[model samples]
Target: MNLTRPAGAVLLALALASVPVTAARATTAADEVNYVALGDSYASGTGAGNYSDALCTRSRNAYPALWAAANDPASFSFVACGGAKIPDVLDDQVSALDEDTTLVSLSIGGNDSGFASTMLSCQYSTLSACERALATAGEYVVNELPGELDGLYATVRAEAPDADVVVIGYPHLYKEGGLCLGGLSSAKRTAVNKGSDLLNETIAERAAAAGFAFADGRPAFAGHEICTGDAWISSSNVHPTAEGHASAYLPAFTAAVAGS
Candidate 1:
């Protein structure tokens, strides 16, 4: 999509200037470190204008592949199927984890609480009803997300104790006070958009408690909101365009893990 560098990206580049560079040598005897990604649709690269399978569940330019490419790891597997819940992580993630794994990234929990499904429902309901749905989803994240995260982390760590784990937070829904037309009104669309921040904050706090790094996508998309110029977020509320993916992901991901 030919994404240009956002203006503030210079600031990120400047911050990146300070970190010491690491030589990309083989880390293990087999010579390549493995990287595994687990999570839901966001991690699967939805709305990024690219997919690897019919379910449209996998993205060709998923952040894991992007991060792994920068790290130049020995092997990488994006077992991040779409609509994966915490249970999926605990049970299905093993196929992706192995002794060679040195890095991991997770973006999950929206599905377990049914945010996607509920959001779809919100589109048809009145504002009060939509808010109620959001509140319910919030309750689940506030209450159950932690347990799910803890379990998933425990499982991932058990499989790859030495891996550096990073969790990518969900992006903002749209331009602040912006408008979009779907089954919902512009105001309701904005409301749902703002709800994502609450979700990210909770996710970040839990990630910190779990001792994992976070690739914050909020500030990266500040000013530039969904369905806008060089927009990093998709018009559909949750997906990201290829351009959006690169802008939202790039520098922060490298800053958190390996630097360019």
Candidate 2:
């Protein structure tokens, strides 16, 4: 799929009503069986990546594992790798997915084109520098991440009509003023984070269009933010920490599958 930036860009905002935990509990045995997972490092749990994959990017503490542990599915296939792009997941993730699959969760497209890297380049550089880079990169990510997400979701649905697909969005990258964010500049961090949120909107839109579940990680993780105590995002404040994983994956999977 061509990943060139597109023309139209819109701020992503959606209101999701939380379903009760009891409501999301698996009713039938089948609901907990035949699970398949796909996505990039975030899905695999980077700083959390020991037994997952050989790639240094995967993590043991990542959300998918957290979800797996919570649900205890009979058959689980987690193909989340580090630095995986939309094309990468589409081409390489099929081996881990199959018709018998009852559920699939993924967090992809972040690395499809080096979004975080581009955002980080502006760190402590200068306001103009950060804005210029983010504007350019945001347009690129907005343009490309959507098409990549659309095609991927379309493919995933075709592969597993019965599966409940959980497309997760990244949480807030920066606190309001980037306060208490480890040691990063609030401005640079906010720009990169805002860019991440833009990409997340695309992911949600695609998930909804495809009859899948979209898990929003922002509000649920508001106070914790990135680097705070009980933080879910890593000390780097970019990737999700163990705390972040708990907030995002388990609850999301549970709620999403509850309706599934």
User: How do all models score by TM-score?
Assistant: 0.80, 0.80
Alpha-carbon local distance difference test for all models: 0.73, 0.70
Model 1: per-residue Cα lDDT over 113-216, one tens digit each:
78777777666678888888888888887888777777777777778877788888877766644454343566776777767877788788877877789888
Cα lDDT tens digits for candidate 2, 1-260? 53343322212111122333344664554455788878877777775535555763656666677767776888877787777888788889856776778889888766765656565666556767777877876776777767777788888888877777888777775565736634557766677678767877777887888888888777667777654656666655367766667766667667876776
- Residue 229 of model 2 has an lDDT of 57
| Local lDDT at 31 for model 1 | 51
**Candidate 1: residue pairs that collide:** 232-244
* Leading candidate by lDDT: 1
